[model samples]
Target chain A: MSDNVVPMKRTGEATPSLSPILSLTATAMNSVNQVILDRMQSEIPLIPALAGHLISGGGKRMRPMLTLAGAQVVGYQGTRHHKLAAAVEFIHTATLLHDDVVDGSETRRGKSAANIVFGNPATVLVGDFLFSRAFELMVEDGSLKVLKILSSASAVIAQGEVDQLTAQRRIETSEERYLDIVGAKTAALFAAASRIAAVVAEREDAAERALDDYGRNLGIAFQLVDDAIDYDTGTADMGKDRGDDFREGKMTLPVILAYARGDEEERRFWQDAIAGFRIDDADFAHAVALIRRHDCISATRERARHFAQRACDALSIFPDGAARRAMVEAAQFAVSRGY
Target chain B: MSDNVVPMKRTGEATPSLSPILSLTATAMNSVNQVILDRMQSEIPLIPALAGHLISGGGKRMRPMLTLAGAQVVGYQGTRHHKLAAAVEFIHTATLLHDDVVDGSETRRGKSAANIVFGNPATVLVGDFLFSRAFELMVEDGSLKVLKILSSASAVIAQGEVDQLTAQRRIETSEERYLDIVGAKTAALFAAASRIAAVVAEREDAAERALDDYGRNLGIAFQLVDDAIDYDTGTADMGKDRGDDFREGKMTLPVILAYARGDEEERRFWQDAIAGFRIDDADFAHAVALIRRHDCISATRERARHFAQRACDALSIFPDGAARRAMVEAAQFAVSRGY
Candidate 1:
């Protein structure tokens, strides 16, 4: 329990960094970056202007990096993965743009949200452009199987989003329902990003299945940690306002768990806060206190750790190499973020 | 000119109808309809609920009919075109959903808009899901050429929408710019829908180009008539509020021509009405009177006639048959709609 609770250092002394996979995929990832730049260009000034504002605004490219690493681990040598990885990143960025519009979020990735800067209309339209651009990349890659996987993932993600929206401010949202939403909205894309590498590598079904498992578990773990971090008051590095889920009345894991474990008074408080949608700083503080008192934050983190372990175990089928080790570390890093 | 200006009977006597094409493609179109229903279903109840609210709510199925007619004209005997047609319809429906959000439109096809009924967030997310579903259908079709044409068209459509947004309320929007916007926003999908049929039939490049041209010209004609009808006020059609473009300050061809033809005082009226966004029924009546006085409605309809003629010319390459005649009539119907 103690080992799982200690935040793993991501980029410091006495820590195994993700440099192994990052370096291994450096050349290809650069090409992917260039493709992203090239494709985001359009003759319409507003199209490029609004798209560039979001695309170049410090996205971290975690999903594309996973794609490159997946390709590397599968011993794929072709350049097509670069385009697919770019497509993956474009889809993720498009989702972020839409999410901000949906959430009416003012800030993202430590900057004012694109919708705030360019207005909601431009943000929504440019997000559509980027999404269309992603499909164009997939078409250019000329792999129907890859297109099928990613497209299905996209549909699932949208369904998950609607599911989340329907569950908003509902204190009775079950753990099963929460996991279903997370799996559809987030894990599906992660799984597709890694599984695409196997499709590119022309690997056997077993390999594709293994990578899919790795990504699915890692995605669940990553989302669990994100949900938990919204309640943690540590680093303020969630790229959003702290306790946004609370303010938004989002039915995240922490809230669900806290409600489940709380006494009648606490239950009433949650019901009033969520259903009535009233949560100022003081209410948020009380909510945080309740979360901490029930140890739901750590409990949520423990769930993430459990999924992360499964993610690491799924990588065992691959040969021992820097890429494999880096993927395992990446899964751990997903849950280990404190900042 | 008289033949082109007179309204073609769509579901009445005294003129040819689209029933030729619709009946010819009934089997395939039914399959396409089924595909739309099947794909819209999801475990998440809200997604299907919202998507169905829009999709099942009386869309004319015109675009998918074009795809089917295109296939029929090309002598296609395979079933893949059904899926492709469904995909094409999904893309169109998805765009409508998003466009309503962008336009803040309150009604569509004479019903309360999906965004109003389901809320903007649900509308945007479900639009995204349908778009993804379209891509999945394209992938299932397993034709890279088809995928390329449709994906590129999707990107261009998004760009066209942004272009239209940027040009909104600007009286100085050039005819060339307006045409570009119309071509990108509407004709591109029509062109792709027909061109894909040629691809499915493995037809000659000449046939493909002919179908593409036919669809493009028809789309241009369709949009031109739509723009012209905004000022007509004779029919209770248009699926949206009368003078919607005027109230929204949309730079349609009628407004462009009216602005160009107006005198100094009238120009000031036009500029203030557009730029100031001050529109009431009296103002709308004045604007309509100005348009009628300037002959812009007939002028706009004349432009539509020219495109309809071009659309008919493009179909001459096809051997005359039910499909060919229906397509030619469809082009005429595009511009000849009275309501």
Candidate 2:
């Protein structure tokens, strides 16, 4: 995890937190935070209540950070990215709300999921509210190109969610399908968030695409590490419960890879657990043991490292600076988890 | 119910069907239908399966018809309105899917609600998909103004829905609050749908405002009649079950009006019925009798008539023609349900 060990160019001391990027974009992030609060405000008390619960909830604001940093990296001096950052956060939060309902999870970020507290109907409707608010922000920005990028991402995200729903509990889900889900459900927004910064900078297609590639690869790596963590995360300070993904029978990359490479009897065991026929503590222990024995978590992290490397490489197009270095460290930070 | 009986200027025979305007915008309506079918298409089988269930389900396409008629009335010749009209329908359908989930509706238009057929999660996500697709349509139309109108309507609709949720089974809900809920939940979209026609036609501010007013009033009138019909809809050809609002404890106009004017004993009956404390077949019959005795249904229709008159008056700014006449009759037709 040392800066020397990381393959990315060493521009400064490796900050373990996102604070470097956050401090660099502190003023703009503050504006983005204000915009998030202002937009979720409504005469309907339920909206602000529920949206505030999630917005002020323990979200790292990573998506918006990527946006602000994306804008800053390209030296864009404008206020529009603030609104766009808030929009990105709203989209991400909306997906989380919907995902909680779909996942039927009781907790999020170590607290009660919004759906559990507010009820499924309110969570779903408030998610809709956040989504509409996102579009309103884009429309207020008055950029058709921005609107097109974000709206398409929104659609792709929904499609990815549906695809994941279909793939749930199906042991035959291929690596390609799993990647497609991650790309659309997670990375699509990341790509859009970063690409939008370039759009605001009015940068050329190459820069826009580069930032998009950076965000997309980072998103993939982040999700891979998350999936790996669900099995055995040493970084338990984040408060995410282990084995929730296994209980939910989510086809994360580690499970998919393990199930694909396992012996016939191991495959049967996975199928039974995934099909919810006989899931128990022993089953979880067995699954974790299998994943560890096969080095599935490490393999997943290895894949994540590859993508993280790609994410750092994508930033080579941008000039070296504090912003670019923080972004590169952010990529390294994603894959360095659970080491 | 004839043209002569209506207060609006008579220019043509009153047709109970929406065919007059539908035929006038036949080509545009066709394109809208294509877009609707096209946008709902996805690689995920459940999306199209569930969306097709609701899309091809027995919806009358009334909202999209309004958009088409509104465009034709404004003498718009472009195809953007077609896309806009499709967007309007998508919004309407998206709300229906969510509404079915929220209301726990078993049936829509004499068919099982999408939530019942496809489960709530898929229905909710597909609804999100349709909403995002609607925004994509507006973005493709490249009109920030259009996006503004539609996104605002979407926000209002969600807020209105939340307002209605708060008011559910609460007899203390005032007529003003009920109207507010209706305005946000239904009329706002109508306003946006009609106003967008003027926007696309590049009409003056006066025309845009006029069309917006017309659609808003018509939407209110339409909802009022529908609420009244929930008590006793003589026009039962549409196959909607009577007393659904009553069974669900929905505080529709008739229920609110009757509850406001009822005697002390009757008030208790209504409070208990609406609170689901004593809802049964006998309660429905008594509720119907009470509504009839208090003239609440007629009073509701009378209120609808006033809004219908306003809707017609809003059209006076435009020139008279078959389209205009059809639009005028459409308003009267909204209030002439029981005849």
Candidate 3:
């Protein structure tokens, strides 16, 4: 997995060597991740019988790591960090369950999805269960601010999903519309999960705003990179098949940009392959080749890097700490994985 | 619709006279039902074009009416009642969207269901959108109590759905479990809506408890009548095809109770029909007839009446206002529909 990727050096960067910070962040994130898994197991009994197979099937756990790292950057040592981490994971899981059902996806992470195994009804209801359980856990935290933030994020995510459905296969979707969907459906939760840590830690207004901005930028960069990976990565390395978004007719940024730049013939190809119901391997190959020819992939990667840079800049207000250093490093890693 | 049903009299018995209270309640309910339909129309622009057709196809808007009647019973003059009514309606619509997907139901209200029309993905996401919209509206009321009640009810309803999935096709399911599922999934929201009035009015604790009990019992009775109607009514009146529950191997209360009292041969028939995966119209007819032979329908109807009576008893704690009287009559109407 690391063969094609060259790790960037930090010589000219604002941050110094991140080796120690990255190591510590990794340890803290793993601990919090374990706590999340444990809490999910305890709360959802059916998780072991049905969901456990998927939970252990191998996921990046990137969202939960971001949450834990966010709490760490704010110097949060309280046990509630565990709850926040679990909340983030639950939100992530809920989205995945609904996504599989929405996309009619059969396999995920190289294994049959919950919908495929337990059937769509169980998957949908279990997803609802996870969402409700997340709320219950948040309520137990007894923070009105946290509740408000999480609830609002939940709404935004749902609205974004609906927006995606409405905009699917629509070649006319603007970059602004695409960003809005990604921001709401993906980045919003990431941003909220991180920003919530400052609120929980009772940080000052300046500190809170900085972390919030950092989280928002990092989330955008993270999603952009994820979208790029869906196009760039291999099926085995990605733990699932590539071209899934294209197969589902989702109008991601690369497709939108490529379709916008395409000539009459290219546009016709897109219409036939995506909108006009002609989806075969040849269509997928043409779509991918067209995207590459338009340099949309590189353009998208550059955009992701811009957000990553902004994320690092947002953390400048933080005191010199290992967690802050790791935050910057993680943003870089998001972009690096795409190359 | 009202021809054979005996109207309730002042002496708590059936009478030939047309009940003015019932007429008034129906009038008020119809007014609120119109409000619900109008509000659903306002949200059409935010949803897919197909959603409008699916939603407006032919929903009965029964739950919204219950919310309106609940609020009116307390003489709630505030316009917030309409918002709450819409919220309840949104929740009901959301549940229906998910239910259609879960059951793979193609037709609802005599037209295509949202899932069938827009596909499962759109239906599920739109359901999420509706639920989020409901929460947003509830939040606007600026009542934390209402938010808490509604959110909790949503969680319970979600749990009940999961419980039903886990228990599906299990012929050994107990009567107690059946009530639990129905109470949580169906009655909880009704109970929450009615009890919310007392919370909003800042009424006495006893009054709140009474309204809550009234709503809960009313909901149970309402669902029992609905279950009975599934077996008794024709496709035209019911709006959707019937006998799917038995075909799908769902063990409703009547089936569970009938199975418990059946002879060995009769038990074998049910086993083959439900557990042995053999279901046809003949099997469905036989199951219904068996339930009838065991007087399960009448027994269930009596249970429903008991709940309705309990709901009426709860209302006795309130003053004898027209609204209260209407609520009492409405409860009677709920159970007496089949007779």
Best by DockQ: 1
Better of 1 and 2 by DockQ: 1
lDDT of 1 by residue, A239-331 (tens): 757878888888999999999999999999999998855688999999999999999988998899888888777776787777887887787
Sorting all predicted structures by lDDT, with the top scorer first, yields 2, 1, 3
Tell me the tens digit of each residue's lDDT in model 3 across A1-339: 223232233566644233544575576666666755665552325544455666677776666666667777778777676676677777778778888888888898888888888888878877775676676666567666776777777778887887887888887878898888888888888777777888888888776677767777878887787777667643236565778888777788888888889999998887766684767777777888888889888888888888888878777766656677677777787777635
Which has the higher DockQ value, candidate number 2 or candidate number 3?
Answer: 2
Candidate 3 CAPRI category: acceptable
For each prediction, how big is the interface RMSD? Answer: 0.7, 0.7, 2.7
User: lDDT by residue for model 1 over B160-179, one digit each (tens)?
Assistant: 99999999988899899999
DockQ of 2: 0.81
Instruction: Show model 2 residue runs off by greater than 4 Å.
Output: A1-6, A9-16, A233-237, B1-6, B9-16, B233-237
Give the deviation of candidate 2 from the true structure as CA RMSD. 2.9
Chain B TM-scores per candidate, in order, are 0.95, 0.95, 0.87
Residues B203-289 of candidate 2: C-alpha lDDT, one tens digit per residue: 999989989998999999999998898888445555577878998888998999899899999999999998988678888989999
Q: Assess every candidate by TM-score.
A: 0.95, 0.96, 0.86
Q: Which ten residues in a row have the lowest lDDT in candidate 3 chain B?
A: B1-10
